[model samples]
Target: ARLFRSWKPQLALHAETSGKNAIVVTAAADLDGAVRDIVKSAFGHAGQKCSAASLAIVEASVYDDERFLERLADAVRSVRVGDSTDLDTTMGPLIAPASGNLLRAFTTLDDGESWLVEPNQIGDCLWTPGVKLGVQPNSWFHFAECFGPVLGLMRADDLEQAITLQNATLFGLTAGLQSLDPVEIARWTDRVEAGNLYVNRPITGAIVRRQPFGGWKRSVMGPAAKAGGPNYVLTMGRWTDSFPNCATSSTSEVDENAQFKEYATAWAEHFAVEHDPSGLAAESNVFRYVPLYRPVIVLVGEGANRDDVERCRLAAKVAGVTMIVSRDDEADLLERLLTIRPSKVRVLGTTSDAIYARCDELGIPVDDTPVTSVGRLELLHWTREQAVSETRHRYGNVRVRR
Candidate 1:
């Protein structure tokens, strides 16, 4: 417990942390640099990392180039694999024996795909890096998570297509693009679905604050807060307007990093904002904030601080968090709380055995924390992702009049 407590602000839960991390190599990318970095990105840690670049969606111009193909294959073959304790070993054994995913990835060559650099399995848990060519779009291997030392290469007509192919996966964790064109980079950055994106660099090895790590789609679960981010502790405590409501438009002690400050301020504004992310002509995904379960009962204990109680009221009022504040006994307030079938009873100041007894009888959870408020922390309690999807087209026709 002490060890776990030491890791404060830990993102309490990370669900479905899987990936089909893909890389796009444009024709204008530095040939040697792309090969070197892509190899490192794909095969580093024996490709066991969640952010490992398992797929490379290369532009047709470069994909068909013999020079590019040969260099990429050679790089994979050259990586040293052996005992991890050996100073010369660059790649080591898998954490466990090979699973079905790894076995199929190493042995099987699906239709329209062939091994450019076939991996030689040293044993059940050890294998040299492998690279496949002619990996068809949406192939069995394309969207699958291998989590091993194997990389698949796919061909794309252009940058747009490359981004499309990269996103054609159940997981959107990480992605990389290698190109010299700023225009292509900008377009890729805007459309790529992964949480962490790298350009002209390896996709893994995310540094704290430099790249606040999280994922999109099924890549993330639970509270969906990025690890090591400003909102990392957002879900640890119940968001309450019960402390102090003093959020300003300007940054004071909000953040030392300009980027983080922007994130916090922008999030606070989300309550009033409805932004679109779908970018579809017909469908819209407006991210907006809504109130949590209503009639939240604020049980004010007799020993509660008067200042804290005022702070709580001011917070709730300012944030528009409506809750029934009552000086009723634990049993009385709990009855009201349970009658509404709402969340647990929230007590301020000091809670007594009667409160616990009531809660025990009601079979509801309870937590106690000092009354406090920060807009960034409290606003999240009232917000969640809500995507509204609509097909603008009806049966064989557009919904709107032309």
Candidate 2:
């Protein structure tokens, strides 16, 4: 309270989080009633905080609800405006005289609409009655976020449009919606991108202890705001480890019927020889590898040697490499190659011949180094080693290998 008092004439108190999250205040009720509650609660704090509702979107259905609007207007009018020290005072004076000027600016906007609550005076503080009524969507009053006792009301065409306008603001800290329809309410609660999605409640009533609070977009900065749940703590830790020779081994048996299976077996055999891991023996026909920081190499070729190509693809997959192939080179391998731009190309048999011819046509130098047919043991060691290295680097020393 002392800090708030010292900061005289506050224009806005925007909530910010250390993390990249947003706080959304949704009022699932009548718009006028919802705005009334927000004004009452916020002014209760002397309108010195960011959680206060500076602008409100009233649903079109209830825009003209006279009874509701009357009650809302009465609530704002009832605020006891006086000195901060007064026990009966529901709102205190502007921290300084200049704050009165800022509050007046918001209250005096000539957007072709009348003020529901005109600014008044209580001692040195500038007091403004709360507002609840019809306003334009693009009204300057609707967009301005006055920290004091001021609320702008605009009608949304539908619930969906209401949510969209609510989220449309760059300030995504808090929003409120009012509706009794459970399905409509649930849909808004889920689709609304605000950090907090409340149902049938006031936007200012967010519980700090039980509910983690923060804003998204410009409203928030870092990640330190505590979110509800214990799992949030794990988001702050880091780990690391190393694998010596996990890829050298031998190839396993082939299942002639499974296309991917043959590929998996061949790849396992290739990497196993480069890195020797006892685990390879059990899963020689499986393609297992984790992604690393390095760009992946995907191979796309004809199905002439589908079995051999599959094996190579499996090997690449296990090594954290990407591979792509066309149904056949005749369909346009150049286009596919242009799309992939692999760091290295592994061509075999007929596919190799087709690629070499294309490379000549495109004026790309083709390396004729004899294709080394690696045994399972050699391929295994290399695959495991690369996978382990990639895991270590990509995760910033977080040990992924068991």
Candidate 3:
């Protein structure tokens, strides 16, 4: 968590919490499968997986039954712990001895009355119930990921409270619910903050081909869609190809980087020849020289000034590109947007020398074409490459002189 805060990693895909996360089990829906899921997600691999269930928010109706709680605890105890090399070992040790010490600290951090569940004394963890709940939403342990064999349990009065408890955290990677009512399941699916949701199933152990996995909010910084499925491949790269026309237009004589003075001439004589006039410089004074789907464009370092920023915005709109302006160059703004499945990301303007070098080092294509008044030509040429259609006959293959 400290590393992420200090370094601000460009691409952070959170499948779990940095603080404690919650698992909501309604009174009407407890089953053997739910208990098994709680055991697997809460204690599997020593609760080291990001998808592990860190907290349990059971309904008051079921939690009031002391017998149920004891049974659940016994199930947790059934999990075996030993050297991972032994195939029979169901749990493993912490990455290091220090990790065990840190988890020990978490147990005492909260004052709330709780039950201790230790599958392995090597790194025994804590579990707290929300019944008669007192902890605030901002509790660091309540929202931070433990990354160990620790799970918290809370009791909710009803379905709504359970959902509220589940959604309180900053992370929204995966969530599991057990219910027989179709309407209740629908409500849970529609409202749960998680990107990956499971009904009547465990939150962990998602198969690649079967379940596309990813998350929302701080849980994932990139596209919120699943990574294991079809959408996953779209993030790899983007391509564009539009050849320039041999014949020149009126603007061909002007400086490629200079601002335009004769919009009427350019519109009537050149752009309007093949493109629709209405779409090309509508009443908004916004221009659309080329057609790009939904490309993400990052404006590097405010780009000279406010006018420069406005210019990039106009150009992106005309080209159908989404623009994000930021001075921080260390962050991979493109990858963050790519998680949402943008067509492609186009980087414009200047950034730090390190960032430029890093982009080159990582093979992330960078377009440093100057955003001068004549930048429209460059934008047009760039958009040509983003053609997604089979037929390239929409416009002439006219290239702008760089």
Candidate 4:
């Protein structure tokens, strides 16, 4: 209770695992590189990390190509799963004795699923990586977050089918697409909904800030201020203009809409920016905003001005999001949360700050960006942040295949 009253930051981090994977579009592309990257991304860390590539939706032609299959199997088989301290060990064992979703994946197969490379339990907590082919759409393996060293392979007639299969899960933390064709890469990246998108590279092991991590749909629980990104600590501190910048615009107009419009030009671009933070010639990193699947629920005080409500509506519109505005003398945010289950919750005016702490415990994200503030930070509350990383150069030379 004292901490709540104190002006201290409440930092949070969600470490729970989710189903994340990649789609290898092997059309007019580097087959050997794809196998190398897929094997590494899917089996790395024994598929224990949330961002590990648990599924691979390969284009039908590539899935059937013997060269691709033989190479993938060879790569999987060569991995030496043993003691983590061993220099020769490629990956470590499961965190504990596998149970639940992961155990089922290791021990059983769905109706239409069959093992391409069967798993061999080599230790109490270690099992040889397994790959399941013929993973039917919407099957148990398709959506389950089986946090183990098991990879599910699905055959897609075309890129469209591959993307559909990739997005069939509720989670969208990290997804990758492998293709040598720039046209296919552009088309797939534009449509794929994920927190992180990688092209021609391993999907796991994201670099800090450059690949700011968090996902939409059910992948994230809290406000998803990405771990190493600019907005990570935003909520924990209150906004203050003690040392004001003359260059920055100060929103002070009595008319909310007019004030918002004054800074409207900078709204979207300010909150998110696409840049190669690494400045690496071999890689391209794009950090952008992706709208959340659910609406943000905004609670306003009974005495809230009409202009304030209008500003909220305009902000959501500009951010390309929908919102539910609840104006009541006593806002029932908890009740509404039970009913609507919004992607996030924010309150403006006399609403008790205590609710924010409560929501945090429930794993429901809370947006503390000042409602009256305009420009830079508002959009972060309305949209999910995504970092798209692509390996543009192969072996330090310009990739010619794409």
lDDT of 4 by residue, 6-78 (tens): 3432433344236557666657668888888888888889988888888888888888887788888989999
lDDT score, candidate 4 = 0.74
Best by lDDT: 4
Name model 4 segments beyond 4 Å from true: 1-17, 240-253, 256-258, 292-297, 301-305, 323-346, 349-369, 399-402
TM-score of model 4 vs. true structure: 0.82
lDDT of 4 at 204: 86
> Which is superior by lDDT, 1 or 4?
4
Models ranked on lDDT: 4, 1, 3, 2
1 against 3, candidate with superior lDDT = 1
Number of clashing residue pairs, candidate 1: 2
Considering TM-score, which of the candidate structures 1 and 3 is the better prediction for this target? 1
Q: Model 1: which residue pairs collide?
A: 242-312, 243-372
lDDT of 3 by residue, 1-402 (tens): 324423543433223233244666776674565677777777776776777777777778777777767777777676666776888777776665534434453444456644445323444332221121334345655676667766666767888988988888867776777664557766876577765566655667755544445554456433333555433454333322132222213543322133233322343454433221223221111112233344545545644444445555655654456666655546665355435444333445445555544443333334443443443243432342100001111134422211
C-alpha lDDT of all candidate models, in order: 0.68, 0.45, 0.51, 0.74
Superior by lDDT: candidate 1 or candidate 2: 1
State which candidate, 1 or 4, has the greater TM-score: 4
User: Candidate 4, residue 367: CA error in Å?
Assistant: 4.1
